[model samples]
Target chain A: MSIPRNWRTRQQRYSLKAEVCNTCNKHIFPPRDVCPHCAAEKQSWTNLSGQGEVFSYTTMYNAPAGFEEYAPYTMALVKLAEGPMVTAQLTDVDAQDVKIGMPVEMVTRKLSQEGEEGQILYGYKFRPMLREAA
Target chain B: MRDVVIIGVGQTRVEEHWGKSLRHMAHDAVMAAMKDAGIETADALYVGNMLSGELGGQEHVGALVADFIGLRGIEAMKVEAACASGAAALRVGMFAVASGIHDVVMVCGVEKMTDAVGDEVTSGLATAADQEYEVSQGISFVGLNALLMRRYMHQFDVKHEHFAGFAVNAHKNGANNPNAMFQSPIKAETYLRASMIADPINLMDSSPVCDGAACVILAPADGYRARAKAHILASAVATDSLAIHDRRDPLTLDAVALSSQKAYAQARITPTDVDLFEVHDAFTIMAALSLEAAGFAPRGRGVCMAVDNEIGIEGRLPISTMGGLKSRGHPVGATGVYQIVEVVAQLTGQAGKNQVQGARIGMAQNIGGSGATVITHILGGV
Candidate 1:
């Protein structure tokens, strides 16, 4: 029917968002409806700085049905500096630069083009932390 | 929870069913199980059919089967856990009885994989992984498992011959199993010499894509027939990190170990007490990993067990007496129930050629997606 609830909710976070548990005082990245640590229904959503460290990653040579053009892309699980772990692509970085414990920051951008049309699916991705360009 | 027992189980031989329709495939399995249990009707029905809605444009399978089997107006539902959908449906039936609700229930798992083309089937199966990330990167199930196998070999210093032994042993067991998809025996050298699909895993090392159906009936202890009285000693499941790269150690299947430990504990039996097992050997490396995860062997020693012939029926702990998914076939949703049916047959002394000697205690392990979701069950012949 409608897009599954989780998929819809995740799609709304075009950028980075975190779930802060009031009871346990833990920030869960990729927010959930409830706090898993404290079992509390009370949670607050906050935009994250998108700064994190790479926990682990892999580069895929073969892609799935729709994402064939994005092959040779890197995917990583990045643990945020605040709290919460999120998985996303590492953009604008050389494959050789991808490694465990690598410092990364989230960046909102278009991930893939929709069908033959130019419709874009905007999503959050990660990249190696770099000095801000003036 | 009330004690639940499996009373009937049946499955059709897996192969290329060119003429069989999906509904007929399911009907044959459910009817066989009903005949085996000597029950004309069940109070409830639970069906697990993966990719049916996507591939066959068929949904509401529970109602469809219930109507066909003349169990109209009964409680019916479908359970899906990707490839482990059948076992998930069994879990639902077990819970229905254990919760002291319905006493007799039918659990069936079916998949018509041959209905689709090869590339389409590959894409559909890949949906089980992280679609946005992993699948989008052109990774199929074979490629993912192959990566896992490659990593295990690198970490353990095991040779490629170890995987070859696993395949050869499964083929030997499958040869004796009439229901197996590949009953013809293959040599280890021949397997090693096959073409590579993914690095380290050859064509023979992987489970074939086939179409089949398996059904089992669950009821309270009092409702079980004499032939169907193999007690459902315990059913336990566990989950690991969803994504492959999220695991702390890719080489170790944490979910398998955890689920098996809980199931064995609940059954009050150790791995040594299990007379035989039907593990999730979707890949040859998976069979080896499952043995290690089940505590039958130490870490990195699964290859040694296979090479020493300790994994066969006459060995210390016979694994996959039904040829496993490797040789028996992987029909996705039906595989878990198929494993349960095989164990029930062995315990009931009904499995002819694939029967283990003096099979008293049997255990089964059905894993999903590289050990992300592992469901384990222990059954005993009382």
Candidate 2:
């Protein structure tokens, strides 16, 4: 990941900002130029509630380069409340504890460091939402 | 358009060729194919490769391979669709010959993955995914498949053990294939005991990352009657969302269904008429998904066909006839060409031990990036 590339997506990484299709009223995460569903060029910016549920997930035993430190971390496809799914790391829960449909909330966290002196990259990661009193 | 036929096919054993360069492996396959076709020069060349730029630090592989094979001045270019590069290139060659623009065209798929050290190759492979949204989150390719497999097992209410048949079947057939990376056979127990790379996707379930090349020569059926081995009855390609999350139903594999359906329609045949299918078995889950999407089995029951031994050579619809990507090894970009070469071998009665009985029609479906780009080809024996 380059410096400019990481810096460019700060809006989405930091605040869970997404684009809503003006025509179909569907939400698109990571923001797209055009709505995929209705092909509507008109869109609106919206911030997500940062709340979702785990759709699917995996604990990567074999991590790629620059991610070895985070080996055996849990990654998940979280279906947001707004309807679009987001792939992010699951925090505040052990790999064994994560389950399908588990409620989660997104939070900003350090993703990785580029190099010894390179910039530190931070992004959204999901953690289990606190349960209500019984 | 005129009918296109495959006249010759060649391949190198799918293995980690430490001594061979990308061009060396490609040249071996190209020469073998040309020799099989009895031609010294081809009118054009299309090379299918994905990691030449990332792993090999070499691009413009089309002209490089052309010069190495002594076909310097011909029309040469590289075609890529992630892992389906080979079949995509073959599609180009098929169009070239069918359009009567070229008399003979050569399509070669080559990849050298072992040269790079450490996780560099893994990173290179990740480039196939949506870099910004998918790989940016630090998930490897296998991780992505693992997520799918987990979701599938949950959605279908299936166990991890049920999917073992796919890997077992691939190894059973690969044991007889001399050019396969893993020539040894594995059993269900082995699959159960194999180490887990990602949850639900054990080591045995995933295809090995190796290096190799495969090639095929295509010419107009009208001009190459004597040398024609099989007629390319259909060539079709379709795509889906690059990010799996973008799809309405991630498990359906709409691209595979669309491409296979298109190919069947073009060939004027249904799935039942095809004798054997060479599907992309990059992972056990993919094999099951492909079978379902291609109409071989009902949804959530593709694994049942393998469990019932229907995917064996002597069974109803044989798949991975030559070890497939699981045991034969998946060289990524080169796998699509390998599928075509294996189908040609079966159609021509050259598949020694893994031959499908009286195979007259065959189908090969190569998928790129978890079913993002699927290229399906149907061939009929002359």
Candidate 3:
């Protein structure tokens, strides 16, 4: 990602900031300019509590170019408590320990590095909340 | 709208063309198709490509290909919809002829993947997904499908091995296709034990990275009855959220369903009436999802079709009849045109040993991203 592109996306990356559609009472993560469902332009900003459950997950043995360091990493679609799904990595848990309905909380972590001297990209990932562990 | 008939078709085998540049492959396919149509020139040229700019360092493939084919003065441009680039080009060509703006148009789907390294191709493919939210999370395109496969297994109570039927069918049909990248058939055991790229997505489940090109020449049906091979019954495209997570039901391909619905409506035929289907089997999971989304099978029941041996050459609904994206080698953009080309082969009785008996109508569905952009086309005997 370009440095400027990375810098511009900090709001949703850091705080899980989302846009709530005032008309439908639905939340859109990594907020678009307008409501996706109702398209009602009427909107409100909200920072989600980051509570969610895993919808589906995978462990990539062959990661992409810059993400080689994180090969064999686990990723999932977490259904946030706010009623929106977000793509995130499952951290602080073994790939074997991750379950479909596992409850998790969001954490801002380093996603990947552009290069040795490049900026370290950071964004949202999920770790199993303290409620359950094996 | 006037009727648009596919008067000519041409393709290079779906495999690594190490000796051929994109322009070279494009020129070969464009000329072959024009010759098949017995035409001297076309009114326009539309090239379907995705990663030429990033991987080939050439973005304007339409102009590049047109000039290379020695038709420098025609209207030319690239039509891109990620992996669906090929069919997207076909759609543009259809509109050109149907709207009467052009009497004859050429559509080519080309991809030169082997020119770049594996990592570069992988990253370039991910650009098809949502860069801000999806790709930013570092999920590779295969990884995204892996997630879907895992969830599908959990929700439907299916085992990973259940997907073997899809691969087996693709390989079985592909083996008979001389143009397929993988010409050898594989047993179910081979697929069940294939190496995993991402958990739940094994090496056999994913389509290969290769270079190839396919082309079709379209013209109005009024003056082309003698030369026409197949008539375009329908050409429709629909889209959904770029990120799979944004969908109402992640498993449901809304775009696939919508595009297929539109095509079925335009073709005036139900799924049951179709004799064969050329599905985008970039991954086995996608094949099953596409089957369900296109109304071939009920939701969550798609795997049953595979497991029951219902997708073979003579089964209830023949799919991947000409290797498909899996054995056919999905050169991303080129895969779509290959699908249509294969469908034409079937409808015209040109499909050799892999032909579906008395195939009167055929459907081809090409998907981009996870399921964001889907284009469906139906072709019938002229």
Candidate 4:
């Protein structure tokens, strides 16, 4: 995560802003321009409810290089209410507490800390929701 | 299009190879193939590799290997498709000959990962997925497959033990392969009790990261018909979303289905007609998914054939006939060519103790990410 790279993705990370193809009415997350469904260049944007359930999940015993301190952390594919699954670290939940179709909602959280004295990266991560969204 | 025939095949034993440099390992495989083909030179060279730029701290591998192999002036370049780099290079060389671009071409697949420090290879491999979306979440490649495994178990009511047969089969065959990284077979208990890396994906389920190289020399089938080892009946490639979460049904590997379907059409044969399948068993989950996607088994039941002992050399559809990624070692980019060399051995009756009896038709499917870039090649005795 370089400065510019992290800076550019702030919107998607901080707010769960995803692309919605008005043509096919499909959702694209991590916000790319091209509509994979209908190839519509012109698309609308929407802030996702960030409400979803766990599609599949895993716990990384050994994390990647920069994120080593968070070893043995739970990560999951959160199938969103908006209809697109997003990959995110599960927060405020233990690996034992996770399950398929476990109801969750997106929240702003610290993703990772850069090198010593560097910037702290914030992003959207999922946590167990108290109840289902209406 | 001109029909392409493999004139020669060669490979180095898959292992750590801490002693050999990337270029030297590649040179050895290329020279061995040249010797087998009794050729002094070729018009072009194609190198298939991944992580050279990251792990090896080197790029432009195409020119590097050519210059080291003593054919500096020839046309050379590297084809990279993550772990499918080996087969991707083979596909490119086949095109060169089939399209009348070149008469003879040498394709080498190589990867050296043991030289790097902590998580260098691990993070390097994560580049195969969507960097911003997938890798940023801190999931290693094993973690990604583990996600699929968990979902698979949940959806189909499959247990983790059911997948052990895949590793058992690969290791059983790998024990017979002298060039394999792990030369001994393990019992089902070994798989059941293996240390867990990512939850649901035990150590046994994952392919060992090592180093090696494989090469195949391709030429026009017209003049080489008498000396052909195997004819390239089909070469097809297809890709899906880089992010698994982006797919409609993450369980179904659409890329594998499309690529193999195209290959079957080109080869004019069904799955029943094929003798063996050199599947990319990077993970046990991948093996199961590939079998289903390639139509070798019904959806959600790829492990059934393995559990029933039908994946052996004497069974209906033998796979990973020469150790596979699990036992033979997945040198990443080199795995595709290794599968081709093993298939040639089976087709030509050179497989010795590991030979699939009366083998003629064999297919090798090389998958790159989880199931993103898939390349399938069908080879047979001409």
Compute the lDDT of residue B155 as modeled in candidate 3.
96
Worst 10 residues of 3 chain A by lDDT: A125-134
Error of 1 at A109 (Å): 10
| lDDT for B33 (candidate 4) | 95
True-vs-predicted CA distance for residue B219, candidate 4, Å: 0.5
Give lDDT per model, in order: 0.79, 0.92, 0.91, 0.92
Q: For model 4, how does the per-residue alpha-carbon lDDT over A11-68 read when each residue is reduced to its tens digit?
A: 9999998888888988888677788888888788888888999999998986887788
DockQ-better candidate, 2 vs 3 = 3
Clash number by candidate, in order: 5, 0, 0, 0
- Per-residue lDDT of candidate 4, residues B197-286 (tens digit): 889999999999899999999999998898799999999999999999988699999999999999999999999999999999999999
lDDT of 3 by residue, B160-194 (tens): 88888898888988899988999999999999888
- TM-score for candidate 2, please give it: 0.98
TM-score of every candidate: 0.82, 0.98, 0.98, 0.99
lDDT for position B85 in model 4: 96
Kindly report which residue pairs in candidate 2 clash with one another: none
lDDT of 1 by residue, A13-130 (tens): 4656566888888876555677756778888777777788876555655445555677666666567787666656789998777766678877777666647764555677888888
Residue A7 C-alpha lDDT in model 1 = 54
Residue B371, candidate 2: alpha-carbon lDDT: 84
What is the Cα-based lDDT of residue B80 in candidate 3? Answer: 94
Docking class of 3: high
lDDT of 1 at B134: 54
- Candidate 2 scores an iRMS of 0.8
Q: For model 4, name the residue pairs that clash.
A: none
